[model samples]
Target: MVRSAYERGVTTLTLDSPHNRNALSKGLVAGLRAGLAQAAADDAVRAVLLTHTGNTFCAGADLREGSGSPAELAALLRSIVELPKPVVARVEGHVRAGGTGLLGACDISVAGPGASFAFTEARIGVAPAVISMPLLPRLDARAAARYYLTGERFGAAEAARIGLVTLAAEEGADGGTGASGKGVDALLEPVLDGLRRGSPQGLAESKRLVTAEVLRTFDRDTDSLAELSARLFASDEAREGMTAFLERREPAWVP
Candidate 1:
């Protein structure tokens, strides 16, 4: 479900599974890992741009698909963190639950005005356990606690303010105008150009320096978090929560 394109030393990995809002189905995750692997092997590739094909960047785990293993999710997040080349995210729509993990893994992220983010796992009776490995190290403590606990939805600007995203592009304006006038693409042009300008070794080494702590967090916590996630997803509360979400109603616990 991931589509790949190469241009000017950048390999763009587009999440193509719009049917499930690019939910992290086994296929989608495998495809994304494969795309990243290819980019890593290609000397001509300077960076990776992660994007989506629909209005929602990703809706989180494929609750409908049976892969429900948080371990796989951890692996996917780690792959991005360990990737030798920088990974930049282009978020023009909504991101939820584990999708935010993908955003957190990227070296840099650009979110358009239309983008929204939420840690909706709590609503489903599960915590954002696996994702926390990548996110907590970067996000502000107070902001993370609020959103993660309440499952509140926030806009691109709020996401940027909390360090979840690097840039939140302004709303509609000519693409030619500077940051204020340009949308996501315009804001991304310079970032992409900067990546293109960096020598391969320089970019790789620089990325390593920035991502070291993220990798350390992954090494220290991945197993326990994955276990916690799996346990929650299997609990009765989570089952009811998932059913309620699929049925478009509040779970019974919602008073």
Candidate 2:
């Protein structure tokens, strides 16, 4: 479900689904798109904080329902990257697979010490295709390549070190307060303060310019990347690997 609240000119949108750890289902994606569109159109909303309910921020896509059609995932990712307002992700727990993609797509991210991250798509026999679009921009090239290939779990500190997260909070610090209503409020105050101090028009214009530059860069190189991902996903190896994982057996691809 999508929940929105406005305070001190900051609009906060939350993905509230404790069950399934707030997984991004098709419905959730639609809710997010609508909420973000509202935020963009509302003049009173100067900034947006995207957070989630439950212990974990999000566990990624609802795989039990099957992997989303490629077109749907691609559209969701595009909306996130093109969101007009500055979107800050307040991560409170482990963010894995598609969860990390959402965090990376945001303008800024503050994660709690307890919040670990991983790109586990390879383990599940899926390509981190759309996720790679955002993650590559947020992380160092070598770091992105390594994590995407290895699917290793890393801590918030390591994420920050690799430039995946901008800020890492200590236990009682900003993001570590947990995902309570009050905690989210406390964490978002400072971000709103900073945005309130800036020129709204300037912020919007700068974001647009930067997005244009980034898209231009991606357009020049994404054809090959997309083809590779599609091929990988369609291969026998990926099917075998995913089935092995679901069956709790060693993948044939693994030594």
Candidate 3:
């Protein structure tokens, strides 16, 4: 579920699926892709704000949904990568796995002080797949390799230090101030105001320049992340993990 609103040429998109911790489901991802596409095509939209509901910004892909057919997941990720407009991720809470991928794809990201990030795919016995392409650019190769391999959770400060987050908040400040719960509104206000003040053409151009560099740096090495993803989805480990999760039991893979 997503809500979109335009004000003073800025489009704000909110994820509204609090029930599943806003895990990215196929329909939700489709809506997001379509919304971003529309914003890219609309001259009136200068910048975009991406935020979510609940304490967690996004939990990740809905593993309950068959790991989403690989073809669909690749298409969705590609749409995010190719979106021409400047998109900012407003991270107010935890973001893990696929959620981290979405943030990595954004042009800019501002996070609340309390926000935490993780790449937990390996814990469940699967690779990050297409998500790794985007994430690798957001972080140093060593850091990316370490986290991707270990599935370790990191806090907001560490996230910022590692370049995964651009701004970190302190306590008691505006909701946008980078302070846990309080600084988000403040942080967004100035950023949104600045966005409104800038020329849309310049903004678009800047986005293109930066994105080009990122693209060059993190271009998908293999032709088909989806093909690899399909193999992983059907792997014995993934099958067992998914079934165990659905059945509300610990995976046997755990020692």
Candidate 4:
């Protein structure tokens, strides 16, 4: 579910589970965690790029995989936030729910115009508890209030304006490559090039300086948040929402 490769001081971890829109199944989480570990252990790898193979960066958790464990999801976000090396998210597709947490955890992210994002948990009768550990700190308060409540999709430009994404590039604007592989490559190269110049210790320490408070928040709140998330997933309301989603209909509680 994850593929890794290293070159020019960056280790790229690409989520490859297109079968379910690259959802965070157990296998994908394990693969992602392992990739982060590998990047941290390698002195030559100064940065990590988190990208995905399919059109959807990640559709949050795999509901078919049995609601998934919120604790596991929390741990993955924590890993990304606490990693000694810098992590950059290259987004050129849709991201939803927990996937947005990954963006919050990353030090920097670049997205193409084609990308769209949503916090869809509320529509499904749950709150964005687990992801809130990182997301609350990254997103603008007003933007968070709107998206978290409505689960509405927004464009990359809006994401950039709200600070959820570092930059958003238009199609063909990135070195005339359009919004494809070459375009993403063009967007990533300069960032990675800049990262390569920082000493490992400097980068690590700088990351520590930035992430300290957020990490503490995670340590303190993850258990309660995971419990809250799990309880919601098991609720009758969420069951109705999930069933309606799969059956192509509005949830019973929807007005």
- In candidate 4, stretches whose alpha carbon ends up further than 4 angstroms from where it belongs are 171-183
For every model shown, the clashing-pair count is 0, 0, 15, 1
lDDT of 3 by residue, 144-188 (tens): 888888878887777777778776664453444433444656667
Q: What would the per-residue lDDT of candidate 1 be over residues 182-234, giving only the tens digit for each residue?
A: 67888899999999999999998999999999999999999999999989998
Model 3 misplaced regions, further than 4 Å: 170-182, 217-222
Angstrom error at residue 66, model 2: 2.5
Error of 1 at 113 (Å): 1.0
C-alpha TM-score for every candidate: 0.96, 0.84, 0.88, 0.94
The per-residue C-alpha lDDT of model 2 at residue 96 equals 80
Candidate 4 lDDT score at position 170: 53
lDDT of each: 0.92, 0.74, 0.77, 0.89
**In terms of TM-score, which candidate is strongest?**
1
Q: Write the per-residue lDDT of candidate 2 for residues 79-122, one digit (tens) a residue.
A: 76677777888887878887887886777788776788888888
Looking at candidate 4, the ten consecutive residues that score lowest on lDDT are 173-182
Worst 10-residue stretch by lDDT in candidate 3?
173-182
Candidate 2 Cα deviation (angstroms), residue 4: 1.8
* Model 3 score (lDDT): 0.77
Residue 225 in model 3: lDDT: 69
CA displacement after TM-score superposition, residue 206 of candidate 3 (Å): 1.2
Instruction: Report the poorest 10 consecutive residues by lDDT, candidate 1.
Output: 170-179
